[model samples]
Target chain A: MFAHPFLQNAFLAGTFVALAAGLVGWFLVLRAQVFTADVLSHVAFTGALAALAAGLDARIGLFAVTLLVALAMGALGRRARPGDVVIGGVFAWVLGLGVFFLTLYTTVRSGTGNGSAGVTVLFGSIFGLTASRAVGTAVVALVICALLLLLARPLLFASLDENVAAARGVPVRLLGFAFLLLVGGTAAESTQVVGALLILGLLAAPAGAAHRLTTRPLRGLALSAGIAVASVWIGLTASFLVPVLPPSFAILAVASLTYLGAAVGTRLRGTRPTVVER
Target chain B: MTGTFSWNLLADLREMWSLPFMLNAFRAGTIVAVPAALVGWFMVLRRQSFAGHTLAMVGFPGAAAAVWLGIGATVGYLAFGVLAALLFALLPAGRGGGDESSAVGTVQALALASGMLFVALYKGFLNGTSALLFGSFLGITSRQVVLLGVVAAVALTVLALVGRPLLFASVDGDVARAHGVPVRSLGGVFLVLLGVTAAEVGQITGALLVFALLVLPPATVQVLTTRPARGLAASVLLAVVTVWVALFAAYYSPYPLGFWLTTIAFGGFVLAYAGRAVVDRIGRLAVAP
Candidate 1:
């Protein structure tokens, strides 16, 4: 499988995507912002379609739109965490915009012959990546992972106790704004690997599994990233072996099953799962 | 497909209904809207939007598996929807917490992956994938409309029966439980109802966009009112109006019906939110000095 250029590209890009998603997802679950990730996934789709409709590169739209909405959501939410109401409102509107752009792209730009573009945005087209595009995706994912590492301590402080962090002058709100932007970037990137519909799986499942498996913050973070990368590798291999399986399906199925395993393990250990206090 | 809007609104509406497809679309949209808004109101109140979203997402796999099995999509929708709801009900209720959200996310992922698997396994040309995800108005058969009506009717009747106790439980679970309200069972029942509503609405707005009818209208009305009766009434009204206007607009325009439905519903929410903000500002100014 590694002999094939496409398989090589898939692994290269999928590895980095999984790393960034795992790190960012640990913080996302810690901060109770999984809903925000969900909202951004839809935003990535709408942004990509909007960009296509306006005759621009879909990546430009994907990144620009998700980032802007993340900032906007940060501004609208209290303590930089948007409530359900805000998330739900934005979610519906973004999906609506996606439909509008789909209509425009189908009717005016590419015609109905190219309906696959929309499907690609919804389900991802990772195997279709060129060598250059895969490298570009890796570079982007590395930058996200590096930035998240730099912000990890302060972000953790802020996420664990916003009031105490604010009292200690940790710039809680700024850190929150910055963290949301990172999440937005990761969400946009994950859309390429898993598609808009299932990006949350890559963002939440491994992190959640790690949380269930361990309470040590640093160990959990490492475990999360490890599980994520393993899922990607295993999923890719499974899909390569079974051509009938989609890559996204394989990846998310592995990720989710890992989480279930952790949950069941914790239950069998007969220990009450430690609940992180907000 | 290039239909122009005319000044005569009545004539245009009559012309719209003159087509059988448009008529069926209207019927289906209306049937989906009422139960969606009703269940969505309680869902928002209970802070279960994540669960509602998960149930809606499950419809994709339901539809895909149905197509794979050569069965009706509605059966798949309702079956998967209720099954997922039951699964959710089995989880320890941790409202708006990280544990609950993670669990919900995991379920959503599993369901979506299963959907992709079903789609991959199906050898036939599944051309209606777009319609199943984004929804289309062109294929609203009379049979589908009638099925939606029956589901809506059953859901609404259950909602009516459990309305009061459900509200009490949702508002204050501990107290309701102390008072012997069967809080847990009521929660389970409501979740099933929400699943059914999500499935019904999924047919009209698509599985991905079910929130257009389920969340937007209820969220908007809750922003506008605190009274339960008034909020429920306003939610139903907003949803029905949004669906009617969207259907009418979509008939004349080239865009899909789901787009118009979501856009109009979102517009109502924005208006409500802004209106509330403006009222609070004015009230503060009146009190100051």
Candidate 2:
């Protein structure tokens, strides 16, 4: 498994993505912004398309656009913050832009005539990414984790209670925006290996599963990251060994199953899952 | 480039009449717009947007499984979407705290993963798999246009019949329940309606862009006015116009209809948003201390 470069790249990229997804996802769930993360995933798709349309590396567009949009979204609702209705509105518009870019890439790009790039971006082509690109993804994932850690306490405070955190002089708005940026970064990097749609499943499943199992915040976050990493590791190994399962499906199944198992276990044991109710 | 540009814009517009598929596309876009906006309006009002998004995604697996089972993808899309909607209702995100989100997210993840797996496994004739997300343009036929029309008509009729009570329940379920509205039943029915719409829209736009027709127009309209009648009118109008123009653009260009529609819808939302912001500033200035 290690000898194959594609497999190696997939493993490295998957590891980085899983680690960041776990850490960021814990905060994402804590903030009750899973939908926000979903929005960023769409943003990533649009950015990737825009980049491809412009003939630049899609990763650049993916990361930059997602980071900017996530921040902008996080800043919304200060006064008359629009609800899911408004978010749904933005969701539609962004996807339109994504389609526009995808069309341009498919029609105007010089060499890629088959229009398969769009599919690859949506479904992910992680196994085909070069070793260096995979390594770069890993590094970016590390940076995202470090920044998230530095802001964790403040962010957690804000997520728990915006008004209270603001009264205590926390930079709630800025932290909220920063948290989205981290999510954007993680989604973009992970999409390199797992693809856009699959990234969502991988990103949410582990943190959700962890949240269902524990009461301690830090422990939950740790557990979330651990579950994410294990999902990726096991998913990759399964894909490698069986050669029948697609990595994305395998990874999603593993993480979602963890969540499912935990959900059932909590019900069976009748232990109340401890989470802060906002 | 000059030769292609020689036709005046209106001449290009008239050319669509000559193309049957383009006509069908126009018809489908126009017909579906109303129901999508209407149902989407209620979905937003109900704060079931998360569930709505998941429902859109659920169609992917439905379509894929349909292909695996040697059926039309549209059949699968509706089948999967409606089932998921009913399931979400059964699980009821209400009162579960953040657990509601967990359930919805898990459902979406599982649906999509299975869709992927089905696609990977099926050895039969499979086409338009990408259309499950980016949508199929120029693929719209008269048959599809009629199917969409039928679904839209049925869903719209149901929505109208139940509009008053549904609106009450959506805004304040507990109050509506206190007032004798069948809150639980309404939730179930609305999910089913949403599922049908999702499947209908799934045929025109891909799963990924479902919100374009369903959510954006209504969202913009809601912000533009406080009056329900006015908002509903604006939403339907915007939706119809967005798709009509989008279909026209798609017919003339290489881009798919969903993209053009989404972009146009997005542009409309932004314009309305900025306009609202400007009005607010002006009002504030007038009241300045």
Candidate 3:
């Protein structure tokens, strides 16, 4: 599998996407913003569909829409983290827009021979990545990971206790807005590897497993990234071995199973999962 | 796609409804809307939107499995939806906590992955997959409509029987439990009901657009009112109207029914939210003297 050029591109792109997703997802879970991530994933799908309907590059739609909506959500919610009500309202609207675009694309573009474009956007087309696209994805993923690391400490402080961090002049709201942008970027990038529908698995499962296993912030972060990368590598290999299995399914299966294992292991060890100090 | 709208509204509606499929679509849409709105009101009140989303996603795999086994997609939708709901109830009630949301995400991922696997394994053309996710109003057989009516009736009756106690438990679980209400069992029952409602709506709005009918109408109503009876009634009204208008619009235009349904529901939510904000500001100004 490694000998194939497409497989090589898949590994290169998958590794970076997993790293960024894991890092950003740590903050997402810590802040209890998994729902925000969910909203962004759907937004990615809608944006891509809208772009396709308008006859533009899907990548342009994927990134631009997710970024805009992420900032808009920050502005809508208090402290840049939207409440469930706001998220639900926005979520429904985005999916509605997605349906509109799907209809438009199907009606006008059906005979153009790219009938599966919508499906590819929904489920991801990681193996179809050209070398250049893979490289582009890697560079974007690295930037997201670097920006996240640079802001990790302050972000953690803000996430753990928003009011205290605000009082201490940590620019809590600004950090929150910035963090949402990173999440948007990560969601868009992960859409390439796992598709819009299952990006949450890459984002949440590894970080959640790491949370269950450890309390130290830095260790958990590293553990999350490691587990995510491992899931990608294992999932890719499994898909390669069993051609009937999709890469997204394999990756998510591994990732979620890891979380389940951690939950069961912590229970068996007789240690309750540690709640972050508020 | 069809003739331009004329000044005569009733004539236009009659022309649109002259088709057999449109009539069947209307019947199924009305059947799905009421219970979906009712159950969704409680889901929003209880802050289980994530869980609701997960149950909807579960329907995709269910449909895929049904297709794989050469069975009706409805059976797969209802069975998978209820099974996932039961599984959720078995977990400790973490109620909007980080753990519960994470678990919900995990389940959504696994279900979607399985859906992909089933799609790959199936040998058929799978052309209807788009319709499964985005919904279609073109082929609503009478048998399907009758099946939907029966499910909706059963679900609505169960909801009515448990409605009062369930509201109490949702409002204050601890106090309700102390008062001898079966809070835990009620939660389980509510989840099952929600699952059934989601399955029914999933057929009309597709697996993804279920949120349009389920969440948007109820959320909009709650934003405008706190009275339980009024809110519930208004939610149903909003949902039914949205579905009817969407179906009518979809028939005349080239856009899909799911799009029209969601867009209209979302419009109602936005209107309600803005209206509430304006009223609050005016009240505050009035009191400032």
DockQ each: 0.74, 0.60, 0.79
Stretches off by above 4 angstroms in model 2 are: A79-83, B1-14, B123-127, B287-289
Query: Of the pair 2 and 3, which is ahead by lDDT?
Result: 3
TM-score of chain A of 3: 0.98
RMSD of 1: 1.4
TM-score of chain A of each: 0.98, 0.95, 0.98
The sequence of per-residue lDDT tens digits that candidate 3 reaches over residues B1-289 is: 3556777878987877788888898899999999999999999999889889889988989988998899999999999999999998987674456767777888888898898889989855456677788777777799999999999999999999999999999999999999999999999999999889888988878899888788999999999998999999999999999998887788778777877888888888999999999999999999999
TM-score of each: 0.98, 0.93, 0.98
Candidate 2 per-residue C-alpha lDDT over A48-122 given as tens digits, one digit per residue, 9 for 90 to 100? 989989989888899889888876776675521225766677777788788778768776884777477776777
- Tens-place lDDT digits, model 3, residues A129-222: 9999999999999999999999999998998888998999999989989999999999899888789998999999998898888878999899
Scoring model 1 with DockQ, what do you get? 0.74
Question: Candidate 3: misplaced stretches above 4 Å?
Answer: B1-4, B124-126
Model 2 DockQ (Cα-based)? 0.60
The CAPRI category of model 3 is medium
Off by over 4 Å in 1: A111-113, B1-4, B124-126
